[model samples]
Target: MAWEIGAVRWKVALALAAVLVAGCHGAAAPHAPASASEWHGNGAMGAADWSKQLDVTITIRDYGYLPRELRLRAGQPYRLTLVNYGSVPHYFVAPEFLASVATRKVEVREQAEIKAPVFTSFELRPRGGSLDVYLVPLRPGTYRAYCHVKDHLAMGVEGRIVVE
Candidate 1:
């Protein structure tokens, strides 16, 4: 009789614990402020490739970049038109482009390491301006682009491109 009571008690406790854990997992968390790399994807994350030569128009405002999301087909070649609407100079960096400002005059892609800048760069400033960059969408993965300016990216100034 004593053993039976102990087992029943343990079962009930386990069932309650399971229910609580399930509820916690299912509950949605509160919304948080946008992050620099806070790209939720373009309206076509899973949609078919609409066109090439992306002809993207990106606007920089308030130390931030607008239309912060991009979707693309992997390995496809395209061109991006970058516009700087901010009051300061910023760079669109492809992390694969490594540099040592302390010595090197220019940043080069790390080819031996299997990394390259899909979109190298386009120096931008305030008001309506444009820059063209050639990109070869390599690999099917989501890539992040952000301002390499001091504390600019930290201020939620970033963009994302999806290579699907």
Candidate 2:
């Protein structure tokens, strides 16, 4: 009788532990702020309704961006989420590409939002960090996006953006 009681208690404890572990795994990860007020210069040209902008995530690894070619509409607003998964810092540089767009804001996780004279390139730190860039392309063209870090571009860390 005592053995049977002990077995039941053990089963209950195991079940409770499983439940706690599952709950922790199901928790959501932190995300960028969704409100216009949370972004810098809320009055910026492309700082329109966040709910209406198309969101895209680009992953940067050791040698390249996941999707080397990106397609965008000329006048549509877009929210670009850049995630760096490599062990070294990388830059998203595309001078001509940025010149063809009306930028809204650039947001780094847990940092201040950047607005105004938009930058032609942005740096991302190594490993598991992200930045959000908002903009609207104003013309149709194919532009090159490359990393300006030492020898990164030569190693094939480059991409293309086609605006139509």
Candidate 3:
């Protein structure tokens, strides 16, 4: 009986170790956008083919923002770049205070209450595009940066940024 109990404990320990390793080394989805995408423009006399990342290392795609989540600290400004990687023209806009709360969340997260907004904002043209807007995370929290084009965000064109 003692031997059996010891063996069972060893098995449980091994199982936990395996789970910890898998959790620590999890991989990102393959279809996910990279730091930057290789998009080409097919202009109908439009720069749409030139879709590219502007100043922000993160980006918004047809239905999502690559890095859909971001992290930052308070009082520091960030140059967020955007590119119309999707078929339609898209832009980034959000309340300024909320934007700050987002980047301020940094490494910690929990329930958040939106008092106001924190972002200025920027726009991008169609057939591939790019734009840059400055950002500063103030109160630490989480927020979504949504494109307010008609039915745009509903189509999955939004991202989350966490500030600290």
lDDT of each: 0.54, 0.78, 0.55
* lDDT of each residue in 41-121, candidate 2, tens digit only: 244454456577898887888899878999998767899888889999988888788766767778886887987444677
Stretches > 4 Å off in candidate 3: 1-56, 97-120
Best by TM-score: 2
Model 1 misplaced stretches (Cα beyond 4 Å)? 1-52, 97-119
RMSD of each: 14.2, 14.5, 16.9
User: In candidate 2, which residue pairs clash?
Assistant: none
Report lDDT (Cα) of residue 131, candidate 3: 48
Give the Å shift of residue 150 in candidate 2: 2.1
Model 2 spans > 4 angstroms off: 1-50
Better model by lDDT: candidate 1 vs candidate 3: 3
* lDDT by residue (tens digit), candidate 3, 107-128: 1114332221223455666655
Candidate 1 lDDT over 101-150, as tens digits, reads: 00101222231221221224556666655554444444566667788778
Predict model 1's lDDT versus the native: 0.54
